[model samples]
Target: QQTPASYYFTEKKAAETRIQPRQKFSHKGTFGHALLVAGSFGKMGAAVLSGKACLRSGAGLLTMHVPACGYEIMQISLPEAMTTVDKHEKINTQLPELDAYSAVGIGPGIGKEQPTVELVEKLLDTIGVPLLIDADALNILSENRQLLDKLPAKTILTPHPKEFQRLAGDSSNEFERLEAGRQFAIRHQVIICLKGANTAVILSNGDVHFNSTGNAGMATGGTGDVLSGIITSLLAQKYPAEDAAILGVYEHGLAGDRAAARRGQSALIASDVVEYLGW
Candidate 1:
């Protein structure tokens, strides 16, 4: 079936209008705190990338909850963000108190260990603020389908094609996949950023907004983590879920586009994308 053109939007001017300008009188607290639960023993880079992007994208205060193995790495890689070490030395096994955070983003490099799965479940049940789920967290949801109903309304899930396929089941083609995403978002009452060229931001109301920036070079690893951080930052700042997803996706891709221009598509890395985040 053909989707209506009216249902599709390109987030250029719309994203610009939604970006909140900082006021001189506004202090760090005014921007809101963001908590990121990420990383594992060998994949601490994911935590670093996400944490750095979170701070760079305007999160006033950012905290990374990582396993002991990642604590020092996160501290040195992202000194601007605070760190909370998990009890488990290799993987995340504890849920930090969420009351202080304005928003949370989870599932970067955290492996699919049983303890981490339990932690994810615990967070889902207890968290009252805006949430963003990505990477391994999305994989956990795929493995434990029952948890889908536990998702808070308007929670954002950023999934590349494979992760989305795992969550929503396989589609014969991209069109089928997009429709599946729309249905999934509507049924779950969550926002889905189906990552790809012109990545589609599917809202709970079934609206689809395609991103206007980005390049194929962004296919590198850790880029999705960067996007999760960016969106989480916006969510922390109190952007409506719809606006956060739309603008975050746009800004993430715009950064990728800028990085590609400087480093050439083949040389661009996720950190380069972070360095180019202009707004």
Candidate 2:
């Protein structure tokens, strides 16, 4: 019989099992470039936060694609990351070269514009690398349920309970929701990082790893974007899909724990979580 101890994933274990050490011969290009397609008009902060977190998590380079209106803001706010501007000033209509990036993360603060639907569809059809889907991107998937089938093998999906409900339909409780998540991962051959307390990382093999870090302090806006960045960064660093999800989720929550300790829950913000990603 399965016991609680059998399922628990603790911080100490996660730290010991984190990404491998960097080699002395490694260069900037060795880590791979990560592309983040995100932001809208007033939500440019989302793009900035995700980009910062991605770099902080060990992505060698980052290119953040945003609407033209956000170009200056992204450049000014995150000088470390390069920027690509979409044709439209407030929405993303043009898609960049999918082959250019080692990994792609999309949907933080992106509004559900009609053109974005087509862009997401085109990405799923064309992208050959691992993809991380979250926030508005998940909503777009719900609207076009058919697109779920086009997801690249081993795609990573980060969703809260409400977002999961939209994709998989309503659930009576957390138990039912998790069962659905496990089935969803198995059916689609993808990883599901179901964000919340414990943040269940459901693998395609029907295994669910519960993160034992993080705190109520992380229950605020923009934190999910940070999580997305961390996972995307891990993918860029070439961690396998299942390992990336499990390790990224654990580290993200562990950062939150550190943030809470330093700032207290009330004062902890998403940027603090990014700052505390020393592991």
For every candidate, C-alpha RMSD to the true structure in Å: 1.4, 2.4
Tens digits of lDDT, candidate 2, 1-279:
121212446567665576678899999898989999999999988898899999998989999999999988998999999999999989888889777789999989998989999999999988989899999999999999999999877899999989999999998999888888888888898989988999998887778788889999999999999998998998988888888888888889989999999989999999999999967
Best by lDDT: 1
Decoy 2 TM-score against native: 0.96
Give stretches of model 2 more than 4 Å off: 1-10
The C-alpha TM-scores of every prediction are 0.97, 0.96
lDDT of 2 at 150: 97
Distance from true location, Cα of 24 in model 2, Å:
1.1
How many pairs of residues collide in each model? Answer: 0, 0
lDDT of 1: 0.92
Candidate 1 residue-wise lDDT, 53-149, digit = tens: 9998898999999999887898898989999999899999999988899999999999899999899999999999999999999999999999999
Measured with C-alpha atoms, the lDDT of residue 202 in candidate 1 is 91
